[model samples]
Target: MELPEVVSRSEWLVARKKFLAEEKEFTRRRDELNANRRRLPMVLVEQDYVFTGPDGPVRLLDVFEGRLQLVVYHFMFAPEWDAGCPNCTWLSDDIGRLDGLHEMQTTYAAVSRAPYEKIAAYKEQRGWTFPWYSSAGTSFNYDFHVTLDESVLPLEYNYRTKAEWEALPSGGLVQGEQPFDLHGMSCFLRTGDAVHHTYSTYGRGTDSLGFSGTVIDLTALGRQEPWELPAGRIPAPDHHADGCH
Candidate 1:
């Protein structure tokens, strides 16, 4: 692909210095937050869960295999749905392409409450090659607070930060209580054949990790504005719900 035009040497150097300083500060802040996150306490997982793989039933701990880290995408596929959530599809499309960077040193997989046969068929239909398995006959999905009888709204006070959530219904993903379907990157460390589920994040509802939205926001930023819909985009939640249609 053709690249954008480069700046003059002097201008490029100045820009580089500014960018490097900003990046260094961002890196420092990120490391500090991660340190705090790492120090957060973990809850006891009392349930012994198992999942269905191509081979057969595999214990939850066995999913990590030899990899030191395992990130599970709690895909939005429940027993009643004929298809996965479109938002999840949007995210998973990116994931399928990302699963194979040789140097990343991380393993990515997906677990859903749907049965293996059903889940496998869906993956095949989507032509997705990423690791996906079924959580049928297990409490793992529920334990992860991604599945249950009724929809969960994070019960604590929801903070609005991300653009999509802005002007969405005022009631937000409450910080501490919603047992909703969580989109998360779970990190793990493996030992022998047993792996420990190390860390996960819930509400404040995940912010942009700098691939798509954040960079776009930084350029044509609007989440800070009146939270209006983009010029050509669809109407906001409030407008639609208040009978604007």
Candidate 2:
């Protein structure tokens, strides 16, 4: 089986030191990007959208829970679906106790297009305690661009319009995927009774937020290790039989 070249301790240390320098530079770049993101201008949220929460109908401002800042995860759970999106569920599983956000005066909640009953039942089944609300029959999802329906609004995903997305070779939402739902996170700032949309990230923008995803991204062989073949792709006979070589 093929493996990373074996090296003496000193040689390995030399390579490790080089990689560490790169990692440090990456951290600095990330810090700069974060600063710029924070400086982004926000838009006023003028819609009077209401979402169904555990306490019944709650306005968009009420979802903030009286916090100065709010982060809403646009979970993809259509009203027709029996459960939430698996990818969204995976990320939700990574969420830890959110009490820390309260300490920072930032509230966190999840909004989905599914009905309250389905969301409650599924949340109970998954043992999740975070605040999740239903956006059914409202423009909440459409305004946020999570639930895509050309009839309601233009088709856009991850800042890419329908034409732009179709022009991509193999990325973004393809044909026949319209009127669909995609997952993302949106940040909002509350000033008195006004709520403003500060920032939103979709696609891979939200991928690295999870601990498991971050760890995997740090490795030389990322989540795309060769042994992990795509569906229907046959592996070679001598390929690492258990994929643990």
Best by TM-score: 2
- Model 2 segments beyond 4 Å from truth? 1-3, 175-178, 219-221, 224-245
Residue 102 alpha-carbon offset, candidate 1, angstroms = 6.7
Alpha-carbon lDDT of model 1: 0.59
Per-residue C-alpha lDDT of model 1 across residues 17-52, encoded as one tens digit per residue? 988998899999999988997787655444567889
How many steric clashes between backbone atoms does each model show?
2, 0
Q: Which regions of candidate 1 are displaced past 4 Å?
A: 1-24, 41-46, 96-105, 150-169, 172-182, 203-210, 221-245
Write one digit per residue (lDDT tens) for candidate 2, span 1-245.
33467899999999889989988999999999999999999999999889999889999899888999999999888888898888788778888898888999999999999999999999999999989999998998888888888999998777778787666654445334556887889999999999999999886677755777678766655567455555336865323211101
- After TM-score superposition, what is the CA distance of residue 82 in candidate 1 from its true location, in Å? 1.3
Judged by lDDT against the true structure, how good is candidate 2?
Answer: 0.81
Instruction: Give the clashing residue pairs of candidate 2, or none.
Output: none
